[model samples]
Target: EVAVLANQTTFFGESGGQQGDAGVIKTENGAIIEITDTQKKLGALHVHLGKVTEGDVKVGDAAEFRVDHARRSSLRANHSATHLLHAVLRKHLGDHVTQKGSLVAADRLRFDISHPKAVTAEEAAVIEADVNSLIRENSEVTTRLMTPDEAIELGAMALFGEKYGDEVRVVSMGEPVANEHAYSLELCGGTHVKRTGDIGMFKIVSEGAVSSGVRRIEALTGADAANYMSARENVLATVAADLKAVPEDVPARVKALQEERRRLEREVSDLRKKLATAGSGATSGGDAFKEVNGVKLALRSLDGIPAKELKGMVDELREQMGSGIVALVSGDGGKASIVVGLTEDLKDKYSAVDLVRIGVEKLGGKGGGGRPDMAQGGGSDPSQADAALAAIEAHIAG
Candidate 1:
């Protein structure tokens, strides 16, 4: 890295939550040094950090310094918008709101402030609207060099942790609304637009909590704000087209579709339960239930049933048997789900948890847990579902 110190320069150093300037310095001997950043050293002296792209340079060489004007313009708009945002936040959220941090960049601006809770969407909209109102006013932005004490006396908001010299630059914008103080006045050293209208527009992209008692807001300005709105409108138009409705009716149509989907889900669930419990007779002599050791033991392996529905199916089957132990296994894809349930009268004689653990072990599962009356478990091997059922029957008979 090469650091160039010139007697006089126009590059703005990195300070006051704004990024450093980037440009190129060309020496008389055709040496091109690409300056990526400008910074301050020992509270003064702008240090241009870059690398030598071509040729060597010695002391006393005359060079031309050129800055990226487009980038600088964008940065100025965002920095000005940040000041308006700060003032509006203090007005709406009470005087307790103070700037904690910020970032003024070419793409967007981010401001961190002391806030107790998250800023709601409605509040963010209002804050954004207020800032844009000031921009629309096209108020002239003015700057003056004043003593720190005098700036503070004029209600200029000085940021904490910033080292201000004897004379600080104070930026003021918009007309005064109170006791001879402008709408926004702050001690800032960052580049900004000459008029608030130069910001063109303002749109808050997001707002969220950054830390304890602090919130951060990220926003876009100028062409970036316009592009953001256009993208949102396009998304809404696409969704409206798919739903066969206009954009104004999209929300109501979506709500109706959601209600219809929930109704269909309930109907499907009822049909599945009926299909699963079909032909399972209550008598002990049937294929579904067999009398073993003076207890009715029912074991069946089925398909296409979700693991979540297994316990409810087991409950219905146990209720049908009046007094018996019901064990059901349902396999889907490569996985197996098993549920073991006992009637209230037989709970003391047999633990559903122990019986289900035996079945789960056969299906390559480690542990199963539930109350003594009902238990559920699952495993990866569906091919071993029958083996799992047989293991449970064996444990009950043993």
Candidate 2:
């Protein structure tokens, strides 16, 4: 479909982490149609789409076409730069690599590639330098069209599970090399520059692995790169001034600052430990052997009882409770905790794990436990704590 001022064209843009391109088109009437947005879609036909706007015009009308010259140029540089970077990555990291996604802006391009390990700063610098070197070498950007069978025969690499028609678009960088020194060549439909040099001042600012085997890279070229560097330098200058240090001395200064910070953290941790000790009291060792269902039961309360400490106390207190039933309750920081212990002699209907599970549930919370001898669980519902205790006391008796 078409209109007087603008025509609808599918453009693939920064959706799904892939950055869209900025371009413009024009009508024959000299009315400029700016292609301000591009998008890629997950659909049947026309994977890439573009939107253009101008004076009101109906569809089914013919309109002239033009892409935003400056924006398109910059985007092409970055997009083409991605190809160069892709080639460099394969050269260094081998052919197991594949493009996960990409974002191309006026001056910067971010590429996500599949790899197992995090890309180090040195590796990113190398990749950037390599791409820039190729650009400086001025590789010709050549385009070729071939049938699917012909592309396969010519040893062109293609994406996995991608649907292709009888004809495909191929973009090549530089002259083809023999076995190894090849520059860059891939099948692509996105717009690109005519030459690698058009992507002035390629650089890789950062790189990191996204997942177990996928990596991400952000790079800049031309003015975007220049601005980033300048901003970084300004930050360094400000920090240096604050520290009364030189530019190169900032790292050492920052390291010393970090050490000071760690020392303060340790001091705070020690103070917290001391405060906890002062407030926490050890569990009491007094009463036990409450009779339930003609079986001796175990119960106790102690201060400063950690979850593990409570478990230990409960284990020791169990023997005294005998084969009847054992239940332990302790409070920590105003929160209620409990553990259940049963004897092997009466393990048939009574289970420590099941007991604890029920205890936590009836208490309006959740809990879990272990074997027939003992299990542990706790809940945050302090109001239901007493009811929970009474329920467990009767549960073991039953």
Candidate 3:
């Protein structure tokens, strides 16, 4: 980094939450130095920081200093908008609101204030409207140099913990308020627009908590605000077209579609439950059941049934079997799920958890958990689902 000190300059140093000016300085010998930032040193001098892009610049050389006018203009608008925002917030959120911190840049402005709770959307809208109203009024912005005491006596707000000299610069904007003072008045040294109208427009982009008792609000002004609104309108238009409705009717259309989707889901779930409970008879000439050691055992493998519905299916199958052990396995997308249940009379002789664990281990799963009468488990391998059920049958037979 390079620092250039001049006897006199036009660049504004970084201070008061506003970024410094950035530009170039050209020497008489054509040496170019691109200044990326300007800051204060020892509380007085302006230090221009950058790298020498061209020929070397020596001491006592005459150079032309230039500040980027476009960037400076953007900064001015954003800084001025912060003042208006501060005043409007205090008006709507009570007098306890004071600026805690801030960041004023070319693209946006963030103002941190002492607020205990989140600023509601309704309150933010009102604050934004009040600021824009004042901008539309095109009030003149005035600055005066006076003693700090005199400025305070005139109702100008000073930032806490900021060191101010005997002489301070006071900025005021908008029409007079109930206190017979300007609507917004503060001790500020940052650059700003000549009139409120120069801000063009104001739009609040976000508001959230920054700290325990502080909230931060970010906003845009002028061309940036216009562009932000334009992008949002385009998004709204696209969504409306996709929904086959006008922009004004999009919300209602979406709500109706959501209700219809939920209703269809309920109907589909009921149909699935009915299909799983069908053909549950143990001795209806099907190979679903066998007498192992005088204990009737029913083992069936199902398809496309979700694991969550397995417990209910097991309950229905156990009731139909009358007095036997029932084990069911359902496979979907290469995953295996197993549920084991026993009749109340047989639960004391055989544990459902032990049977399910035996089946789960065969399917590459670790353990199974539930009450002794009923248990559920799953595994990653579905191709071994039949083998897993066969293993359970062998265990019951022993």
Give the candidate number with the greatest TM-score: 1
Per residue, candidate 3 scores C-alpha lDDT tens digits across 85-106 of 9999999999999999999999
TM agreement with the true structure for every prediction: 0.91, 0.59, 0.82
The count of residue-pair clashes in candidate 3 stands at: 0
| Candidate 3 accuracy as lDDT | 0.90
Better of 1 and 3 by TM-score: 1
Tell me the whole-model lDDT of each prediction, alpha carbons only.
0.89, 0.68, 0.90
Q: What ordering of candidates by lDDT runs from best to worst?
A: 3, 1, 2
Positional deviation of residue 128's Cα in model 3 after best superposition, in angstroms: 1.5
**TM-score of predicted structure 3:** 0.82
User: lDDT: which candidate is best?
Assistant: 3
* 10 residues in a row with least lDDT, candidate 3: 279-288
How many residue pairs clash per model?
A: 0, 27, 0
Could you give the C-alpha RMSD of every candidate to the true structure, in order shown?
A: 2.8, 7.4, 3.9
Q: Encode model 2's per-residue lDDT on 148-257: one tens digit a residue.
A: 77766666666665778779877788556686424676767667888778877876688786777889888888778778888999999999999999999999999999
lDDT of 1 by residue, 1-398 (tens): 69999999889898878888898999999999999999987887899999999999888999999998888889999999999999999989989999999998889999999999999888898999999999999999999999999999988999887878899999999888956888999999889999999999999999988999999999999999999999999999999999989999999999999999999988987887775566443222337568777888778777877889888888887888899898888887778999999999998889999999999998888798899999989898877877887888777778
